[model samples]
Target: MSDTGGLFDGVLAAGPVAESVCDGAWVQAMLDFEAALAWASAAAGVIPEAAAVDIEKRCRAEYYDIAALGAAAVRIGNPAGPLVRELTASVAPEAAAYVHLGATSQDVLDTAAMLVTARALIALRAGLHACADRLAQLAEEHAGTVQAGRSLLQQAPPVTFGLTVAGWLGGVVAALDRIDVLRGERLAVQFGGAVGTLAALGDNGIPVLRGIAFRLGLAEPVLPWHTERSRIAEIAGALGQASGAVAKIARDITLLAQTELGEVFEQGPPGSGGSSTMPHKRNPVAAVLAAGSAAQAPGLVATLLSAAAHEHQRAAGSWHAEWRPLTELLRSTGSAVEWLCIALDRLRVDPARMRANLEASGGLLLAEQVAIGLVAAAQGAVGRQEATDLVAACCLRAGPDDLAELLAADEVIGKYLDRSRIDELLDPTGYLGSTAAFIQRAVQDWRSRSAGYR
Candidate 1:
């Protein structure tokens, strides 16, 4: 990313997750597994405590040459073999014998992935909760603030801005809940020896697995899942869904902030989002970055899905296929969360503009309201379609003072309603039915769910 010369460094990739899944972080995670394994073996009485301490002292990632290890991995096919080989050489012969005694390369690698994933999820949770908080606040503040609802890109009827933000908050809350579940249930230690059977440890294998889980703060699995890949697939799907949720907010904000409908504004510094040539352009740069991350998500998730087709006990190529793609997919989701948080936290709302735009349609949106009001007043005199067409036809002609005035001057429907009732029918603010109640429900639901999560 540094070599790319600040492509999305600050915009998308500047979140808490960027550091947790870096190359350096991967190296450290793998090294931590080797040390944790030694600790687990000692606790299980499979290896002497003194030898475990000796091996642990030298299991630091810094002791290994990073570049040389990467280059050596090209011939061996993975960095794990070279890393283990170097770790073995770094320890005394007595200690080296027990360094990776009961484990295989996949155990170290899979557990390392879980470690990185756990830390990154913590960051993701924080970012997601922050976004939810912002939306919750907006929902509460704008509960009664009226705006025009649109369908197929055209104005339809009246709605509260709060309800729209509530929808976005609900999606983020759902995603957060599912990701937390996956973290709790699927984040188990991977410790199957050689071919999914702990042949090296014999009867001590299960005990060693429990020991590793306790030491690493992970969960113990029912069995070693070297070949079963549902855990990884489920997590990838959750992240993919989360990315979609993030993109929804971005898409809505970008759409609302268009020149013709200046309902919101993107957040950035003065010089940020400025066009290269246009002097007055302030583009929705945050949304652009989030959209880019989402655009990459489906393909990255596909790679993980395709890689699930692993062979027999261990996959040859398919197992290798997961490394780069899974990391990239997680990175893309991380970036989306990070950028969406920034965009949401500092969002600029224009309630006045929203009101103005709703009324800009000149009561065309209030046709349904007027028609329904006429029916209630008419009893049996005004037919539904007749009232509907009466208001619809009024939309095409010049009005007296406003829509209500024009409706009152109508030939047939005017006999049913007086001026005060017409005013009620034409009020967009009054027509936002149950918007505040829905916002409160969404906000309360989020509070309840997130309280349990925390």
Candidate 2:
């Protein structure tokens, strides 16, 4: 890679992603595959246990020059070949002979990829849980806090902010559940030798495959999946779904933090989110990071899907296409979840501003309630459209201190509804129908679901 990744990675990649999927980690995983292969072969009696111990002793990636190995790998077309050559050279000839006995280049590379991914998932799971828990907490805190429900950028009716957060939390919860399933099933060992057959091992392949998988904490497939690429594509898709879920929340928070409609803001120290030209600005830096990282998922995932369509058995250029994109998918998704955890945890909410925005639409926001009140009060004197028109006309002027006084001034509407009923109808808090119930459902469901994982 370059000194830095693409524009987004520098802005959005978190420390965990950098640590988990870096060249060092990759090399370590490859070395781990070598060590496990040696141990498995020895356990199967293909090699002496003493040779296995010797090979394992030398398998630490720290002992090798990764830069030289990486350069040699490019020329050799894969890292395992160059790595095994150096390994055999380092150990006694008898022990070195057992270094990568039954495995091929793809086996080492693919298994290494799994090891890297398994480590990455540990970070991702924690991030997602943290974010979800924060959202659930916020949902409980703001259960009855009223805000304007918007549709197509226009005010529709009253909705609690808690309900809105519940929707976002719901998406994240689904992503977490999907991740729980995929990690268990997809993070398995890849041990197919050259040409997808362990013909060289002669009936010992299955035992060796199972042994190495057990050593690596991975599942062994019943048969070689050299060409079946669903697991790879599924991992990409699942990761994309997770990033996309968090992106929805980031986009919403960014919108909420807009200057004209500042219902909420991210909690940060002084000078955070400051614009160079506009000193008064406090931008949504955390949301920017969350969105920026998530933005890479779809295209990278598409590349993974394309890479899955490789040519016969081992693939020509197609399999090679997967290395970077898959790593990027893992990095971006994990980083997105990490940043969202920060943004959600430190989010500063202004329930007062949310209520003000709800009422900013004037009594027009209560037009639906007014129309419903008119049906009963007017009896046959007014219809729904007439009631709607009357409220619209009255709303052209600013509302009075009380909506009851405002409507009492109306010669036409005063007879239909009185002051007490008007006050009751115009209250946004009373109009939040089932919003709190939904929020409660979300919080309780989250508590229950998160319990199982814990």
Pick by TM-score: which candidate is best?
Answer: 1
Best by lDDT, which number? 1
What is candidate 1's lDDT per residue for 395-444, written digit by digit as tens? Answer: 87845346766788898878989988887888887787788889999999
The TM-score that candidate 2 achieves is 0.90
Go through the candidates in order and give the C-alpha RMSD of each one to the true structure.
2.4, 3.0
lDDT of each: 0.85, 0.84
> Any idea how many clashes model 2 has?
0
Q: What's model 2's lDDT at 340?
A: 86
Worst 10 residues of 2 by lDDT: 397-406
Per-residue alpha-carbon lDDT of candidate 2 for residues 1-454, written as tens digits (9 for 90 to 100): 5664656565667848657988889888988998898899889988899998888888888888988998998886887888899988999887876778878888888888888988888889888888888889888888888888888888888888889999999999998888788878877788878887888889899889999999999878877776788888888888999999989999999999998889999877777778889987888888878888899899999998988886787888777788899888899888888888878866898999998888776666887887778777988888888888877777766553445566766777888788778888988887777887889999899998796654
Scored by lDDT, model 1 comes in at: 0.85
Q: List the pairs of residues colliding in candidate 2.
A: none
